[model samples]
Target: MYSTSTQKREWTYTPEKLAAVRLETNIKFREKYESVITPEELELFVTPEEELRMQRSIEDAALKFADKFRPHIWPSVKWTALAFFKRAFLVWMVMMGCFYLAMKIDEFYITIDDFVKNMNVGDPRQNAERILKLEPELMKVLNYNLTVHCPYRPFEGHLMDMKTRMLLLNFDLESIRRDSMRFFQNALQTDVLLVYPPSQIALAAINFGCMLKSDEILREFLRKMIGIEEDSWSARDVRPEDLEKLEKTVTRVNHIMREVEKQFVAVTEQERENHKSRLSQIQNLLPILNERRKEAWRAGGCIGQEPGLVTEAPVDSDDE
Candidate 1:
């Protein structure tokens, strides 16, 4: 029984806390009223006849309420609208996705052409045919089905601007573009995009792709971009230490994408399905793992078997 003041103020209570409070309040009520109220007297007061009367009254009241709603029932229009909207939204997503793909494909191939010229390939004709033949296998590795979802859509403008900015800094823009595009292609096929934000993923892709560059200006740009996005901090506000830390994060993201791409290339579709199933099972156990930790904390036990120590961790759920 919370105090009346709790109603006036904004009070938040967890289920366990609320239940404990309620039980304690009832115990105090019983202790105070023990002189006039006894358990035997309370039991006799709620006799069988009284219980039946309460049940009958409840049922009658419920029927009366139901009768009021009978005239208002208009054939459940909300569910029908909901179903239509679901289908319509799915269609819209598909259309927009197709548009994005077309634009990106044109851009990608244009850059690829320039990249090819820069490399001065020994046999451009053979290379073109080989790339065309590999298209189906590449799509298979991407696990692309009916839907084509990508994080790149949001970062598209930022990256284009980044290229312009890098060129002004006198950096090797051509190599950065080629390598970053390759990393982006590999990253699109991996789950890293789901794990990280679009900005971070883009920076990581670029960071890993441009590792051989001597300038290190792109890394500084990325650190500032990420710092500003995450903390609203300007270029001058970002410390060298923070820049170094974020650089490591980008490197890690790139490494993970590379590893995932390797695995995707190595595995067959059947093996991929098996891997997916195992990952699903492990994911299902995550909630139970967190609940176990909570139980240990409540019992004054640490997760690693130490006494009187509790560990609290924020659970990272997969929303995608």
Candidate 2:
């Protein structure tokens, strides 16, 4: 009965307890063998010790075999080692793929940053943190709009040519008219209102407004330009000569509009042959007139100056 009870108690030991006993026995056995062997021959007769050394040797051999092993060795130990190597290689491949994807994402971000910096009206680098949040497509759109609509003095040459060829020739006239009008409006809202002038913004708005036959915006912009000229004057001194010159400009613009209207009337009244011939003559003359206007503005050095433009309001010392 006592032997049976002891056997039942041994059998009742849990898996956890049994594993702990095995680990303890292994440790004790290793310690005993290490103590018996001479430090020199400790490399030799220990079963667990020799088994560990053999395992390390096998691993090294497997690594060397894996390096040289080929697919031709079908049912051999070298093939078995190759299988282990292939599994390790598959894991490495997956890791490399993930790393490449991450790098591509980083590259996309850098491209977007460069585009925004290039397109910015002000120093885009100054707003690097904010600009980084914008997508690449939005940056492209902004750049396109700015290039097409923003007026710089350099663009005056191009605009003059485009206007004469497109407007007077009446080639894609409606599209040109619409683009010119929208460009003028965008220039006014973006360049004029936002940035200090005499800048490309104001120049672009003025030129576009003039091209589109938008009399109201054109007149307003001209008035603003005149105001700039006034502010540039040392005092409120309105020289009679300057005033006369300003009046002459206003008259000239009005006369040009009248001429355009008269030409339209004549085209309606005349025979097709006469009308076509007259329109051709007008087109030939338009480029010469455009060049003359550009030269006059250039000689006067009044290309960007508004007659009475004020960049900012004067601060009152009394307020401070």
Candidate 3:
């Protein structure tokens, strides 16, 4: 089912490809304004890495924002909101807007006025208008494909499997479930969602949970799951290639967890303020730069042909 899903078909990317795409976007943004703006002004634009860091902070803030709602937002809806926010190329200003759209798509409707009032941001009316105006752009960016398959479901499945299949460990499954879910939550802060399957991520969460409980138990569980015998390299039922792939997936997920631990710190208020100012400056300058681009294109005769004028004929235009 996952293999046939749109996420696997269209949204997934390897780390190198993901980094390359980000770098290309970074370069493209710089090129867009390079000729129009001064070098000092150009330096103010954030790099792809900086943008990612800011996004991570925004993600945490978005979760906090959702907590303000009166009736609790569904966990699935929150997951979908986070997915939309990550997929849509957005800044801090539109973070709430994206989440609002996610809630709508997920059929968890909240009135705009109520939403804005709860947000407690500047100008409730303006916030409502901004959210409405940006809705179309977010939909366009997502290609109107709203389905997001999160790891939570598969996570539960894996837990069920472990409870029944790997009985020898005799560990308390309920105790690790909370930690597994926590690790899964932390996975969102990294690129693992884009780079790996949800099922693999769920298993990785289990691996982390087990590792925390006991490394020896973790190893035994992995050996059994991967079908590796104590005396030989051969697997029991899992294909050699499949086993290799699973090993790599688990290793990469663990690596991402470690990296996130080292790199993702709680975003400070001052840093967020600076990010907002920088984003605001960039937004203010984009229009001027775009107009200059258009002017240059027109001057160079590079503009496309304008729509041809319609002419009246013997037959009525409407009839044709």
Candidate 4:
């Protein structure tokens, strides 16, 4: 039989108590992660009233400038056919320039020859990185995505939810947003999107992106997402499997993106020549490595020394 206090404690979880607990949990969740960009706001193409006000202000300023210029230029025939023709000519010039660019795009396409060392590479991760690192002018050729999922949407959603809180925390929100989005973009540049769920991939991106911007905030922000108290969020306490997955995902992300970053960093002609010079100076190190291996084997007794080197010529029973 249970003690009276035990029975009372077990029965203490009443309907009202359960309701209150659930409500409290909901409130806590909202405090930590309520989406700052609501669904309606997301759906709107332009909801920020400030943007509209800015546009209107610009238009009003332009009109006021025109009105002021009109009287001063009126004596110079401001409304003359020559002025109208000048406007038309400028518009035609812009149109023709645009048309020429469109037609001669191939001639103007930006390129850096042979970014990837192996063109015939079959690794999906490597291949994807190659495509992503291809000249930005090649973006039009690569626009249509065939990946199983676009992680950008999910990542943007997650970022929208936490952006305000991150700002309040004195983080450089713009840097975080930019880098995090780039990380997500890089994840798509590899087979990582296929290997991991977009959300998990995004979590990995958030981890790395935070590191790139401000290493200190990564753990603290992750703890906020996990809804744990500051002291209770020690990273070392995470389960081994979970930690391994997170670490592996971040490792793969960094590897894939590092190559993409190389494209942005200029490789000067001198540097290229120096690289070639280093290659020419390089001898086949395989033989040296092999010799070291053999020496290690001999040291470990895995390989025998020269014949009779470590042994007596004979074990003379008479001597013994």
lDDT value, candidate 2, whole model:
0.35
Model 1 TM-score on a 0 to 1 scale: 0.30
Query: In candidate 1, what are the lDDT values of residues 94-141, reduced to their tens digit?
Result: 111222232233342233233233223347556445545544433232
Candidate-wise lDDT, in order: 0.41, 0.35, 0.71, 0.38
Q: All candidates: CA RMSD in angstroms?
A: 26.8, 42.3, 7.2, 31.3
Candidates 2 and 3 compared by lDDT, better number: 3
Question: TM-score order of candidates, best first?
Answer: 3, 1, 4, 2
lDDT of 2 by residue, 16-47 (tens): 55445445544654463442334554333234
**Residue pairs that clash (backbone atoms under 3 angstroms), model 4:** none
Better-scoring candidate (TM-score), 1 or 2: 1
lDDT of 1 at 151: 37
Q: How many collisions per candidate?
A: 0, 14, 0, 0
Q: Which consecutive 10 residues in model 2 have the weakest lDDT in total?
A: 90-99
Q: What is the lDDT of candidate 4?
A: 0.38
How many steric overlaps does candidate 2 have? Answer: 14
Off by over 4 Å in 1: 1-149, 167-174, 214-217, 223-255, 258-262, 267-320
Q: Give candidate 1's total backbone clashes.
A: 0
Deviation from native of the Cα of residue 7 in model 4, angstroms: 49
Task: Name the Cα RMSD for model 2.
Answer: 42.3
Ranking by lDDT: 3, 1, 4, 2
Task: Give me the displacement of residue 239 in model 3, in angstroms.
Answer: 7.6
